[model samples]
Target: MKAIIAGTTMPVLELTLDAGERIIAEGGDVSWLTPGFDIQTSTAFGSGGRGGFMSGLKRMVGGGQLFLTQYTAQAPGSFVAFAAQLPGTIRELAIDPQDQFMVQSGAYMASTPDVEVSVGLQKKLGAGIFGGAGVVFQKLAGNGTAWVQLAGEIVEYDLQAGQSLLIHPGHLALYRAEMPLEFASIKGIKNKFFGDSLFLAQLHGPGHVWLQSMTPAKLAAAIEPYLPEKSSSDNN
Candidate 1:
C-alpha cells in the first residue's frame, strides 16, 4: 500500500491499494475515487458528517446513520482508520457498512465487518498559558502508524536519540508514540512578555515531530468577520 497527498492549501490524501489493501474514513469525507483506491472522511472532519455545526444540528433533529463507501476491495482482515480532532469527549461508536466508524473520547467495542477503533483525548490549554506552544498526542495502540491531517502550515523536526527540541504549540500535529511530551519554560519571563520568544512543548525524541501549517486561532481570526450576525454576537 502507498499514500500520496494531493492538492494545495486544502489538500486530499490518496491511498493506493494493491488489490487487497483497504482504507477507512468517515461517511462525509468522500469526494472522488478510482478502482484501485477508496476515500472516506472522519465524521468530525471536513464540512459535513458529525463535525459540522449544521450537520450536528441536523442529526439531533433527525436521527439516522450516515453512509460511506470505499473504491476498492480488502483482503478480509486488513483495516485502516481515520478521525478528526474534536472538542470535549467522544461518547459512542458509529460505523457504516463500508468499514467506517466514528469514535469519541471514550472506549467502544468492535466486530467483524467493522474496523476496530479507539478514541484519545487531550486537554485544551488556554492560549495565554502556553502562548505559541502546541500540544501533540500519539496513538498508543493499533499498528503504531496513525495518520493525522491538520489545517495549517507543517514543519518537521528531525531528532537523534537522546536529543531534544522545542516548538510552538500551534504548529504541532502528531509524533511518535515512544517520544515523551512535556511543557518547558522559554527561559526569561521578560523575553516571553516582550515577544522575543514564547513557551514551547519540549519533545525528547528519537522520532519525528509533525507540525500543522495552520492553527485554530488563526483560522478563527480569518472567519470571524464573515460569520452571521447572531453567531458573531455569540462570540463576543
Candidate 2:
C-alpha cells in the first residue's frame, strides 16, 4: 500500500493498498481520511449505543453514522473498515509502513514503564486563570525507558539523572503517568510576570521525554478566524 497526505492544513490522507490489504479507523476519526465515509461509533464512546433517551435520540437522528465515499481506490483490496467494541476500542490505525501503508493520528502519545507523569498543581485550577492550561511533569521512577508524541514541534531539554526541565503546559501532550507532579513557584519574579514563561511543570528524568509542536492553543489560534461568529445574545 502507498499513502500520501495531500492538501494543506486540514490535509487528506490517500492510501493505496495492494490486494488483501485493509485500513481501519475509529468512528469519529474518519475525518482523517476523505470527507465522506461510514463511521460507526459505539456506545462506549457515548455515541448512544446504550445510553439514555436523550443520548440515543441525539446520536441516532443527529446523523446516525457519518458516511462518506470520495475515496479513489489506488489499488485493489484497499478497503476501509470500522468496528464497535464494548470495552477496548482500537481507535488508532496501525498499518505496516513497509507496504506503503501509513497510519497517522491527529495526535497521540506512547509511554513505557518506570516513567511517571502527573499534574503539577495540588489543587484544581480555575478556567478563568488557567485558560485550559495545566502543568504536567514527567519523571523516571525506576530505571526504564518511554516515549511520547506531540502534535507540533517539540523542544527537548537534556538533563542528567535527577536533573529536571520545566516546560509550558501547552507544549505537553502525554508523559509517563507515574511521575510525581506539584505546583512549584517560578524562580524569578520577572519570569513570573511574563505569563508565557511562568509556572512550568518540572520534569525530572532518568528517562526520555518528548513534546509536540502543535498545541491546542496553536490549533485554536489557527482556526478561530475561520469559525462562524456567534451572536451577542448567544453569549447570554
Candidate 3:
C-alpha cells in the first residue's frame, strides 16, 4: 500500500492499495473511499489477532473508538481517504519493533494491519490531571506504518538522554513511547482568571517529540465568546 498526504491546512490522507492490501483504523475515520473494497467492522485486534472484547474495552476507556474498521482492496488501484478533523497536518510515521510512539487523544488516524494501538497510562496523578489529554494516551506499537493528525504547525525535537522540555499539556502532540513525562509547577505564576493551573508537562527523552501549535480546547475557548448564545426560547 502507498500513502500520500495532500493539501495544506486540514490535510487528507489518501491511501492506494494493491489487491488484498488492508488498513485498519478507528471506526468513523474514513472520509471517502472508492468502490471495490471489503470493509469489516469489529472489536478484534488490528493484526487480526485474538482478545477482541478486552482490547475493545481498553480502547474505549482510553478515549478511542470501541470498534476498529478494516478496509481491504478487492483489486489493484483501490484507494481510501481520511480527512483531518481540525485545520492541521497529517503525518506518516514508520513503526517497528524498535520504534514506537504515544499520541495525545484524537491525534491518531489510521495504520497498516500490523500496527497496534493501546492505552498509554501516565504514572503520576499530577501528570494525569494537568496533561489535558488525561492519563490514558494512545500507544502505537508493532511493526508497520501509522498516520496521525496534529493541530496546526508541527515542531519536532530530538532530545538527548538527559535533555528535557517543559510544555503546556495541550501542545504536546506525539512522542517516543519510552520517553518519561512529569509535571512541574511554575514558580510565581498563577492563572486565576482563566482557571489554568501553574503546572506544566515536563518530558524527558532520548528520543523524538512532536509539538503542535494549536489544540482543540484552546481553539474552542478562543471562539466561545464569538459564538451565538442560546435564547430562553431555544431552551424549550
lDDT of each: 0.43, 0.36, 0.83
Q: In model 3, how many backbone clashes occur?
A: 0
The estimated TM-scores of all candidates read 0.51, 0.44, 0.91
In model 2, the runs with Cα more than 4 Å from the true position are 1-26, 32-40, 43-76, 79-106, 109-123, 129-149, 157-160, 187-197, 218-236
Residue-level lDDT of model 3, residues 1-236, one tens digit each, is 88999999889999999999999987688999999899999877553254487887777766788889999999999999999999999989899878988998778899988887777754343433544435457888888899999999999999999999998777999999999988776766665523455667899979999999998877887899999999999989
Cα distance off (Å), candidate 1, residue 145: 6.2
Residue 154's lDDT within candidate 3 is 90
Q: After superposition, how far is residue 100 of candidate 2 from its true place, in Å?
A: 27
Clashes of each: 14, 19, 0
Best-first order by lDDT: 3, 1, 2
Q: On residues 22-124, what C-alpha lDDT tens digit does candidate 2 reach at each position? A: 3322235343343333333322222212333444343233223222112333446454322211111122122121111101112312112112222122233
Global local distance difference test of model 3: 0.83
> Which prediction has the highest TM-score against the true structure?
3
Residue 164 Cα positional deviation in candidate 3, in Å, after optimal superposition: 1.0
Q: Which stretch of 10 consecutive residues in model 3 shows the poorest summed lDDT?
A: 123-132
Runs in model 3 deviating more than 4 A are 47-50, 122-135, 193-197
